[model samples]
Target: MSVRDPNPLDSRHPKRVAIVLSSPAISTTTGWPVGFWWSELTHPWLAFRERGYEVVLYSPAGGRCEADSLSDPRDPSRYSDTDLISLGFLSTPKLAALVEATRPVSELSVDGFDAIVVAGGQAPMFTFEKATELQRLFVAFFEAGKVAAALCHGVALLRYARLSSGEALVKGRTVTGFANIEEDFADQAVWEMGALTRGTHLMPWRIEDEMRALGANYVQAGLWRDFAVRDGNLITGQQNFSGAATARLVIEALGG
Candidate 1:
């Protein structure tokens, strides 16, 4: 894919995008190390790059980010063998380097990009939740009229990201994230593996429950389906599978 130049005068300048990922964190409930989902990052990246958009990877804490092992297609556990998109992305040394050393969110200038995409995994439940800097950065991009997108657990960041007016960013907008049914399936899978108790939760709160409580019109498709919703400049995907769809929406929003 050809990278777009950022200069507006150049005619060939491509729109710029910032993809924020969570730094490595251990799931307190399941005691598993997690960061970003491989497909959540790679699929959207492929979509954006294919459209000739320039993308940069970022993290709240910077440095290398870990991928949730279950999201890895080559993982011996075979949970994601069908994820050929992520597999192809992982095999590309140049493209794979983007996740290995990410710039911290603090170093990014919101005005420099046309859009922002936040990728989620098990770690967002711990790291992205209540992240003031991330909240501000997302709000800045949103308030600037830039396309702001999030998928799966990454949407949890919207729970506390308030506008300068002190209102929740998702208050009246439509959005979607990892659904309750999907989470239940994941929990059951963990339980079957003896990694969690039957009644224990992988996350403290459900994304749907929280989004509803905040007054956002939270929508979901069938469990594990590739669902994405766009409300003007804000776009959200239902789960890891919806990444590319979500990215395409962002591209369309940017007038690509």
Candidate 2:
């Protein structure tokens, strides 16, 4: 219910963070291309970087990862047109290279990083729930008393990850992710796009629905607000707009 190990992590020369991202995938409900969200990844990365934390981008299978087109600042949709952070990140070759070819999440170990943050996007709704390997890695960090965090639908991993005692990591804990209100809006947007879809539900599962099913005390701010809750070392953001706020919580927990 609070910081697991509050001792400052600054003893190390600039902390290291392992940010796991969802790789490319197709949406089952809408038959649209899906990947990580640009703002979710960039905002958090900047928060950590500005704190002098070394961050590494990793994918489940390793290789180039793509961002959901609508989340892209350069997209014609203008959904994220004002996202200068992602625009700056993508335009700069060196910083952009981070997500270009990510190392495999399987190669990661708690020994190499101070914290882990799973970014969310369209792909996560389809890929993260059944990602046992990602669940294991995330649980590893948490069990080791390290800072473990996730944003948006990426928090889906918590629904299945269990502690050594076989209890769900989120059981009876306080958390937040993409809320049902936000999901409803997303569903409407997809329907408005006239995608060849059978239903208005744009996702296989909703983050709020799943987390609540797991018995977590799911809390949230207004839709699209910068809300993040830190139940000890496990931190979660409300939605894409909450990325930097979530990362700041991690930074706070780490005493960065």
Best by lDDT: 1
TM-scores of all predicted structures: 0.94, 0.93
What tens-digit string does per-residue lDDT give for candidate 1 at 1-256? 9888552232388889999999999878777788899999989988888777888999999999999999999999998999999999989999788888999999989989999999999889898765778899999999998988999999989988899999999998999999999989988988898888789988878999999999999999988899899999999999999998898788779887
lDDT of 2 by residue, 1-256 (tens): 7766553445368889999999899988778788999898999888887777899989898888999898889999899999999999999999888888999988998999989999999898888766778899999999999999999988878878899899999999999999999988877776777763536587788888888888899999987899999999999999999998999899988886
Q: Which regions of candidate 1 deviate over 4 angstroms?
A: 1-11
Q: Number of the top candidate by TM-score? A: 1
Cα-based lDDT at residue 122, candidate 2: 82
Error at 17, model 2, angstroms: 0.6
Question: Each model's C-alpha lDDT?
Answer: 0.89, 0.88
Backbone clash total for model 2 is: 1
Q: Could you tell me which residue pairs clash in candidate 1? A: none
Model 2 clash pairs are 2-232
